[model samples]
Structure formats: structure tokens, C-alpha cells
Target: MTHLLYGDRLHLRPCQIDDLDFLHKLWNDPDIRRFLFDDRIISREEAQSFVDLSIKSFKSGYGLWLFFERQSDLVAGFAGLLDFSQEAPSLIFGTNPLLWGRDYATEAASVVLRYAFDTLKRDRVIADVDEPNAASIRVLEKLGMSPARRTIVNERPLLYYEIRDRVGN
Candidate 1:
């Protein structure tokens, strides 16, 4: 059975193949696509590929999770530790634009980070945001992630951030 994760206001489950349509549409939303996929439209095939990867990653103890409002069951967003097998697993998250400023991103991400550091025994995680993505930068900062470095991706200025598991053994 797929595991479910919960936050104070959101409940999350491993994204399934059936969710590809929702994910594709959410990712392709003009307000959202710019912060991810280098602002390119996410094709259904690519979304399917990502769901496939999430399924595989679950076996290894980390992957993508789609979150929903606990009371209304409204599908809010997603959060996950991507590239888990790498030396530094990176964090990824997004919410419907209508849900912005509601702390859904932060709450969902907090659950993923706990799973990463506590359940997966990871030491640190990284995230990169387009320089203009102030909302995401704020979410990472609220999670106590600090600026690590800067780089360019697809000619877009990106700022990377990192957070170590301070509660490490």
C-alpha cells in the first residue's frame, strides 16, 4: 500500500500514474511553470516520466508526494526529495497559485524534510530557485535553509540553498 504523510492542514500521498493529468496541468500553469522546468511547458509524457520516477524512488524511502487539504480534500500541491541517491538530495515543491501565501508549500516541504532527515537518515538537502522566485526563496528560508551558491540554468539566474540536519547524530 502507498504510504500517506500528513501535515497540520494537508495530507499527502505518493503520486500515482492516474495523477498525471492534474500534475501536467498544474505544472503548465503560467504562474507555476516559470519556477520549474526552465519555464517550459510540461508535456504529459514528461509528467508521466516523473510519476514513474516517483514510484521507483518510493522503494528507496523517498520520492514525490502530492498534498491535499485535510478538510476539503482540495488538491493543493506537491513536495518531495528528488535525486535521493545522490550525495545531496534536492527538495522540490509547488502549490496551485490560488493557494499561495497560505503556507501550504512550507507545510508540505516540512513534512518532506522530516522524512528526508529523520526517516531517510540524510544529512543535508539542497534547493535552487530562480532569482526572481521570491516566494520559494522565502519558503526555503523559513525552513532554515541558507544560501549555498548561485548558478545559471537555461540562462536564468538561480540561487541554491542548503540545510543540514542539525539534529544529526
Candidate 2:
């Protein structure tokens, strides 16, 4: 059976094909796409490929996880490690716009970070943020990640932050 992860107020499970609709809607939400996809709409097929990748990633000890509020059983967002084939996995997460400011992103991400470090035994993890996204910067900071570098993607400035597992835990 697939494992379930929990936080103080949320529960997370590996994403599956059945979640395609929810993911597509989340990815296409105007506020979300602006920061996550540079305002471009993700096609249904593209979203399906994402689920497919998650399935493969799970076999490798990491993948996307869908998180839901414990009380409501409502999907608040998604979080997971990405792009580890080429290098260390980078963190990625998003919360429902209506649920913004409640720190759901940070909450979900914190669980994923632990999975990466404590469970998967990764030495470090990183995240890429759009330069103008202060909220995400705050989320990464709250997770104890620090700026690693800066670059441009699609002509937009981007910031890369990283965190390493210290000697203890």
C-alpha cells in the first residue's frame, strides 16, 4: 500500500491519475498559473504527464504528494520533490488561492522536506522562486532554506534557495 504522511492539520498521499482533474484546475487557476506557469495554461495532456511522472518517481523513493485539510478532507494543495534525475531534487508546492496566507504551503512543504531528508536520506534540497514572489520566499525561509543563486527563466528573474541536512538531524 502507498504510504500516507501527516502534519498537524494535513494529510498527504502520493498523487495518482485520479487526481488529474484537481491538478489541472489547480495548475490553471489564474493566480496559481501566474507564478507557477508564467501565466500559461497547462493542457490536460500535460497535467496527465505530471501524474505519470509522479507514478514513476514514487518507485524511486520520491514523488508529488497531494495534501488535504485534516478536518475538512479538502485538498488544500500539493507538494513534492522534482527534477532529481539531473541533480538534487528541488522543492515544489502550491496551495488553493482561497486557502492562501494560512501557511498551507509551508505546512505541506515541511512534510515533504522531512521525507526528502529523514526518509529518502537526501543530503540537501533546493527550490526555485520567481524573484517577485515574496510569499514563497517567506515559505522557503520558514523552512530554513537559504538563497543559493539567481538566474533568469523565460526572461523573468528567479531565485534558487537550498538547505542541507546538518550533522544532527
Candidate 3:
């Protein structure tokens, strides 16, 4: 069983203690945070704690991982299955704004979706997107996820989407 996923243009590895600074910068970037966390900036200490949890999640054999460009080895995005003991795993993804429209997010997400359904044997995976995030909503749709409902989360309207194992096995 491969722990890390490799794609034509990118690779993924579990977050490490060394990744604290990267996550810190990622979560705080104005362009990234605006959509990822509603522009709320996190302190370095909070970033440290997040990395610690990521490490713990990695130790569990599954969790969030960082995406890196294969050639430059630069962190391009973050994605993975967020179990959270939910009925099914939650799909999460974020990519650098500078690299937008290159299909990196979709490709990385395809890899994670395969891992979740085929490798992890998950029956389904779900994603919750803010209604205004048309780009993300399109990504999920391109991944074959169907919008299931509309609801409010954190006082923001969201659209829920889900995709089942293609074979339904």
C-alpha cells in the first residue's frame, strides 16, 4: 500500500514537523485565506499546533497531506481525506492562487478521491463548498461529485456534494 500518492505533475506526502512554516504561510496568504478560512489569519503558534495534529493524523496512516510540484518540489497545494469520524470522509483541497487554472487542483483531487475510495475502501466521500465558490464547486463536479443539498455553515450558505465509489462495490 503506498502511503504517498504520486501524479504526473505532483506528489503528496504526509505533513511533517518541518512543514509548520509552509502551512503557516499557506493559511495566512491573503488570497488563500480569503477563501480557505474567510480571511482569518492564524498565529504561528496555531500553525504549529495544526502541524502537530497533521503529524498525528499522518501517523494514523491517513489524513491531510501537502502537494508538491514534481519538478520544482515546491508546495503547490494541500489536500486529503479528513475522516473526522464522519459517516464518510470529507474531501478538502486548496491550491496556490498563483498556479490557478492549471488543473492542478482537479488532478490532485482525483488522486485523493481514488485513494479514498479504492485504497481506503470508503463507500463515499463528501465535500462542502461555500455557495459563492464557483470554482471549487466546479472542481467537485468535475470529479463526478453531485450536489446533494444546500445549507448554512458558520452563518455562510454552503452546498454539499458527494461521490460514491464508481463501481459501488
Error of 2 at 33 (Å): 0.5
Model 1: residues with Cα > 4 Å off, grouped in runs: none
Better of 2 and 3 by lDDT: 2
State every prediction's TM-score relative to the real structure.
0.96, 0.96, 0.91
Tens digits of per-residue lDDT for model 2 on 75-165?
Answer: 9999999784466898999999999989999999999998888988888898999999899999999999999899998999999999998
What 10-residue stretch in candidate 2 is worst by lDDT? 81-90
Report every candidate's CA lDDT.
0.90, 0.92, 0.84
Candidate 2 stretches greater than 4 Å from native: none
Q: Per-residue alpha-carbon lDDT of model 1 for 99-121, expressed as tens digits?
A: 88899999999999988888788
**Could you tell me the lDDT of residue 27 within candidate 1?**
92
Work out candidate 1's RMSD over C-alphas.
Answer: 1.3
lDDT of 3 by residue, 89-136 (tens): 788888988888988889899998988777778789999888899899
- Candidates sorted by lDDT, best first: 2, 1, 3
Comparison by TM-score, 2 against 3, better one:
2
Off by over 4 Å in 3: none
